[model samples]
Target chain A: MNKNFIILGGGQAAVYAAREIRKNDKESNIKILSEENFLPYERPPLSKDFLLNKKNQEDLFFHSSDVLKNENIDFENISINKVDFENKKLFTKNDDFYSYDSLLISTGSENKKLSLDNNLNDDIYYLRNLEEAKTIKEKVSNKNKITIIGGGFIGLEIASSLSQLQKKVTVIEIGSQLMGRIIPKQIADLVQKTHIQYGNEIILNKQINKIIKKNGIYEILLNDNSLIETDFLIAGIGSAPSVKLFEHTNLKLDNGIVTNEFCETSIKDVYAAGDVSNFYHPLYERTIRLESYQHAQNHGICAGKNIAGVKTEYTSIPWMWSDQFNLNLQLTGICDDYDEIIERGNDINNGVIYFFLKNKNIRGACGLGIAGKVGRDIRITSKLTEKNIIVDKQILADQNQKLNKLIQK
Target chain B: MSEENWIEVGSTDSIEEEDLIRFDHQDKTFCVYRLTDGFYATDGICTHEAVHLEDGLVMDDEIECPMHQGIFNIKSGEALSPPACEDLKTYPVKVDNDKIFIKID
Candidate 1:
C-alpha cells in the first residue's frame, strides 16, 4: 500500500509542498486541507492588484484543478479541529477522520485582531484572504473616508491601493515612523513622503483606543482622545501564526510551533511549515519565525521534500517584497541586528537601496524604488556580511563600479 | 578571420570605441557595443520589461534597464537586479576589418 501524506492548511506553502512531494514520489497519496474554499492563490496581490480591482480572483491562483488532477493530489476544503498524534489521524470540524503516514502543518496565518469592541460590523475589514479583499473592494466607494490601522507593509500597500481608487484614506500607526520594524528611519521617511504626495493622510504615534459604531458610521478614538470618523476601518496591524489546532498535542510551542532544522515537531511523524513552524536558523543562531511569502514557500518546499523520505535541511536567506504606491521594496537577509547602514543612490525623486552592514559586511539590504536595479549588486550585498568581505561604501554607491568586480575580490 | 558569415552592419566610422548601438536582424533586436577590448552583441530588450536596453545608460560592462532600471551584464546576459527575474540571451559577434556581423543562432 502507498503511504498517505496529509497536509493541513492550503496556502502557497502547502500547494508548493504538495507539488514538490508529488514530483519525487508520484504514487504517494497526498491530501491538502484548507479552511478557505478557494484554491491556493497568491496572497501578495491582495493589497495591490486584487484590492485595486485591476485583477480578478482567477488571476491570483497559483494552480488550477487540472494541475492538481494531473499530479494526483486531493484537496479538501474543511477546517481541522485537531490532530490525533498517537493515532496518526486528523479530526476535521465536519466529524471526518483521515489517517496518514506523514502530516504537514502549513496553516499559514490570520490577521491579528484589535482589542477594541466587537462593534466591527460590515463596515470594518481585515484584508487577508480573497474573500475579505473582495468584500472590502465591493464596499468601498468613491470619496469614502477609510481609516487603516497599522503602518506596516500591508497597511501602506492597502492605503496606496485605496487612494488610487479615489478613496479618502487615513493611516493610523502607533509607531512614530512608518514601516518602523522592517526599514530604517531614512527609508521609512521616503515612503511616508510618497504616501503624503499621493494625498493620503498618515497619523503616526497614535493608537486606536476604541472603535465605536454609531448610525452606520465607525468612529475610532485614539489614545490621545482624538476621534476620526470613516466609512470603513481596516486593521492590517499584523498576523499571529495559526497554531491553536495543535494546543492539545504534545508539540512544543515557543512564539510559534517549535520545529527542528528538519521541520520535525516534537511529536513523531508530525511536521510544520510556513508561518506555523518556528524553525532554527543557522545564521541568526536562533529559531526565527518569518511571515513573508518567500519564507513560507521555502519552508513548505523543505518540509515536503523531507517528508517524502529525502533528508534535507531548510536554510535559505530570508527575503520579502512590498509594492506600495509605485515603490517596489525588496529586502534580503535579516536586518534586525545590523550595526550600520550603507546608503546607495540619491534619495530624491527616485529611491535608494540601503545595505545593513556589520563588521564591514552586508547583513541585510532594503531597496526602495530602483534599489534592485543593480541585480549583481543586490546578490553580492546579501553575502557580503556572511563572507566577511571588505567593501568600500563609495564603490557600492557609484553606479560606474562593477558589482561583479567587487564581489570577485 | 572569415568574411563569409560576417555581414556588413554599418560603417566602422559610425560607431566609436566604447559606444553602444542597436540593430535589427531577422525581426529580433540586437545591441552592439564597442568595448575597449572588442565588440559584443546582446538582446536589446530589458529582461524586466519590454524596455529597450539601448535607451539605457551603459556603465563599465553592464547596461541598466530603461523601464525599471534593472542592470544586466553585457557579456553573460545575466540580470543583476530584481524586478527582472530572467536573463537576456547573448549572441556571438564577429567583425571583419570594418563590417560587423551578429550570429542569429
Candidate 2:
C-alpha cells in the first residue's frame, strides 16, 4: 500500500527519516516542511570550518538538488503553525493544511536569548541555523572585539571561530567550569585550559546583569558590577526543544515529546526524532534526552526501519564529541551518577582517558586529546559498558593491558 | 609522489587471520584486512569521522568502526550501516609470493 509521509522541520533527523522511508517504500509520497529556505544540511560546521572561512556555504549542505529530485522528496520552506493529530492533518505557516498517513516530527531546538533591557540591538547574534552562522561570520570581519555570553558547547565553539580570526575574544560563563554539566570537572578544566592557552580571556561563575548600548558599542554589566565593552555580542547560552506543535495534540511531553524504544510518540502512526525526542533508551534503562548528530541519525534509521515493518529498537549507547582547539573530547554513555573515576594520563591536555564506574563495572568513559592506536581502545569503552559485566579494575586502569584482553573475561 | 604507484607493504605472512593492519603511504592511511576469503584493503579512516578502521574489530565479513560502531563490508568497502553513509575507498591488492603490494591511485 502506498503512504504519504510528512516530516516537520528539515534537519539531519528529518532528512534521514525521509531518505529511510524512500529507501523502503519508494511509492510513498515524502514531503519535508523546512523552516529554512535551503534543504536539509549539516549543522556541525557552523562554528568550525564554515565560521572560520575554511568551508563555503555550499560545502555544509548534506543533500544536493539532484539527490532530492532523484529521491522524489519535496522540500518546502514552511513551519508548522498548527497541528490536528486526530485527523493527522498539519497546517503550515502559510495556512496550507495537509494530512498524512505517517508523521515524523524533527523540529530540533531553538537558542535561548539574553533577557537584557536592550530592546532592539542590531549587533547581537544568536547562531541556531546556517543563516545566522553566515551573518555572524560576515560581521566578524569588520569587528575587532567580540564578547560571547554563555560558555557551553556552542559558546566554546564560537570562541574557537573568533580565535581563528585572532579577534580579542572574552567568554563569560555562569558556571565555575566550562561544559561542567556534560563532562566531569577534570575534563571541563582541560577544555578551559586549552582555550586559555590559546590566549582568550575566560571568566567563570559570572552572570550577565544587563546590556546597555551607547555610541554604537555595547556595554554588558556583570552581576559583580563589572562592565565589559565590546563591538558586538553573541549569545550561545543554551537551547530548548521546539515542541509547541505537539503540545496541542495530546502527545505526552516530558522534557521533550515522549517516545518509546522505537521512536514512536504517544499517538499511533506518529513518531518524533532528533533533539525534540525525550526517548526511553533500553541501553541506559532510563528516559534520556540527547541532542547530538549521531543520536538523531541513528534514531531516524531505527524509526524508519520500524515504520517499514522491521521492528528495530534503538538500544545503542549514547555518545557525543566536541572539538576545542587541538583537543578532541569524545565521551560515551552517561557518567553523571558514577562513584569512581579511573584515569590513565597525569594531565588532561597531554592525553588522558577516564573511565567512570559505579559497581566496578563501566558506567561511562571519556578521552581527551587521545587519538591513533590508543584512542581506538577508548572509543569502544561504550561497548564494554553496554555488556553489563565487570572487568578487573587493575586491567582497566593499566595502560599496558590491551583493550581486547580486558574485555575477554 | 612515490616513484612507483604500487608500494610493497609487507610480507603476506604478517597478515594474520581475522585481523586489520594499518599502513601509511605519503600522507594517506589504508587498512589491510585478512579475512576467511583472503586479503582486502580499504581506506584507514572511517567515513563517518577520522577514526582508523585498523583499530576497529573484524567480525565475519564486516569491520566495525571503533568510534561509532558503524560497520563496513571488508570485501566491497560498502558502508553497511548508519552513522556512516558514504562507502569506504577500496584498493586492489596483489600478492607476489611473500610480498604484499597495494595499488594506490
Model 2's number of clashes is 0
Q: Which lDDT values do the candidates have, in the order given?
A: 0.79, 0.81
Report lDDT (Cα) of residue A288, candidate 2: 87
**Candidate 1: which stretches are off by over 4 Å?**
A348-350, A370-376, A383-390, A407-409, B1-105
The TM-score values for the models, in the order shown, are: 0.82, 0.90
Error of 1 at A388 (Å): 5.2
Identify the leading candidate in terms of TM-score: 2
Candidates 1 onward: DockQ, in order: 0.12, 0.34
Cα lDDT tens digits, model 2, A238-309, are: 888899777766999999989999989999988998899999988667888888888888887787776766
Give the least accurate 10-residue stretch of model 2 chain A, judged by summed lDDT.
A370-379
Which runs of model 2 end up more than 4 angstroms from their true locations?
A120-122, A347-350, A370-375, A404-409, B1-6, B11-22, B25-29, B34-37, B43-88, B95-99
Model 1 Cα lDDT, one tens digit per residue, A208-269: 88888888688888899998998888888888888888777788988788888889988888
Fnat of each prediction?
A: 0.00, 0.21
Residue A106 Cα positional deviation in candidate 2, in Å, after optimal superposition: 1.0
